[model samples]
Target: MNRRTLLTGLASLPVLPLFSGFTLAADSPLSAQPPTRLAHPPSYWRDKVSAEAWKVLFEEATERPGSSPLDQFYEPGNYLCAACYLPLFRSEDKYDSGTGWPSFTQPIEGALGTKLDFRLLWPRTEYHCARCGGHQGHVFNDGPAPLGKRWCNNGVALRFVPADQPLPPLRG
Candidate 1:
């Protein structure tokens, strides 16, 4: 290699640790982490969900606002993670956040996990179903009283269970 190229790479070696250290921190046990659960192969999930649901749950793609029928759906029910059928939010917590997605004030205790999302160059609290590690949505500070937290969810990632219907038992 040229002398110039060799020297340039050597100069960058010091900076590499700064970025690699960030990755190590993420893997640290002290980090706020989701509980470990039974894992399935990607093919198993692909066979279970729709193309749209797959994009949102597995690929972390957001669905269009106001596009989900669940946005207008206010019937008494429980909202569940479509991937693992884990009950996440209750019908009583649902509200119109004007963001078009199904907004909730909170989730069932330990039903979800969170991480900081820097996708838009700003950090947002992104949450996922704890049972299956499926992407659900982000939680924001602006919302109704009592919690003032808006759990902005992608409707495609949820399955609504009517109040009269029984939800499937949570998976261990």
Candidate 2:
């Protein structure tokens, strides 16, 4: 089954503490990344996306990429959190992995946390945001060269920032 279906099926069952393992160390490169920060919650996307998206990003749930338009976003743009517009993944870091959802080789340092996901029977690794703790997607060993990592993300949980604009400094 696809990752989303697996996630849904897993949700129907009780969660084990061990199911949430696979933490990247605080000093991990991803942990050193930056993102847009807000003192309060977002008003725009709070009312923009469907209820499911709200449940996923805001509530730290997962959204299936098949249901999210973001899966097809190959344009050069930044990926922001749908619920908060926090810049997460940039288009430059993205590449076509033919993995159904948006895929990236890198994220801004310190923006994401990696953990082990057992939802698929196999011990797969997953990553999410540090600030929002929203489910982004899984990391597979089978990816393009150099980095050799694929960060598969749920499109519904992300927003696109066109490459034409300069990204703001990540919040400290």
Candidate 3:
């Protein structure tokens, strides 16, 4: 099915309470500290990221599910915000949710900020990078045990840094 058709169908479905009252906790010691916030307008990121990434990060557009190679990518690395390079998630939290997009069980503490989204005619928790305020994705409760939270992310909105390599400096 097309993206519009799929999203339309999703909008018609009942909103679940999976995301209600959910909070993020640090999964490891490395994630204990949050990145400092960056004060840059969305336009500042337009030239830094690809057109498609710009749409997802700044325009709050969702990419088609299963379109991101990160969906199947399992590696020892970190996932940073594509727009500002803030480390958002660790590789250990990555998992297969069979939802096409990259899924995580948790995020680095203080790495994201969420607000209620009503674009679908229902309340959904939309998360963004805490540093640059770039849209990342939504968080849901349907996930593995312990936390039972799924951090569904747009692959285009993220840049993976393999564990063997040094992370690039954060961009504006």
Best by TM-score: 3
Residue 135 CA displacement from its true place in model 3, Å: 0.3
What are the per-residue Cα lDDT tens digits for candidate 1 across 99-156?
A: 9999988777657766666687445667777767788888888989876788899999
List residue ranges in candidate 1 displaced over 4 A: 1-36, 169-172
* Residue-wise C-alpha lDDT for candidate 2, range 28-136, written one tens digit per residue: 3455334433444533446666777767655556665466566666778788766545677877778877767778887767666666666759566677666555667
lDDT of 1 at 56: 89
Choose 1 or 2, whichever is better by TM-score: 1
| Candidate 2 TM-score, true structure as reference | 0.66
User: What are the per-model numbers of colliding residue pairs?
Assistant: 0, 9, 0
TM-score of each: 0.77, 0.66, 0.81
Which TM-score value belongs to model 1?
0.77
Q: Between prediction 2 and prediction 3, which has the larger lDDT?
A: 3
Specify the poorest-scoring 10-residue window by lDDT in model 3.
19-28
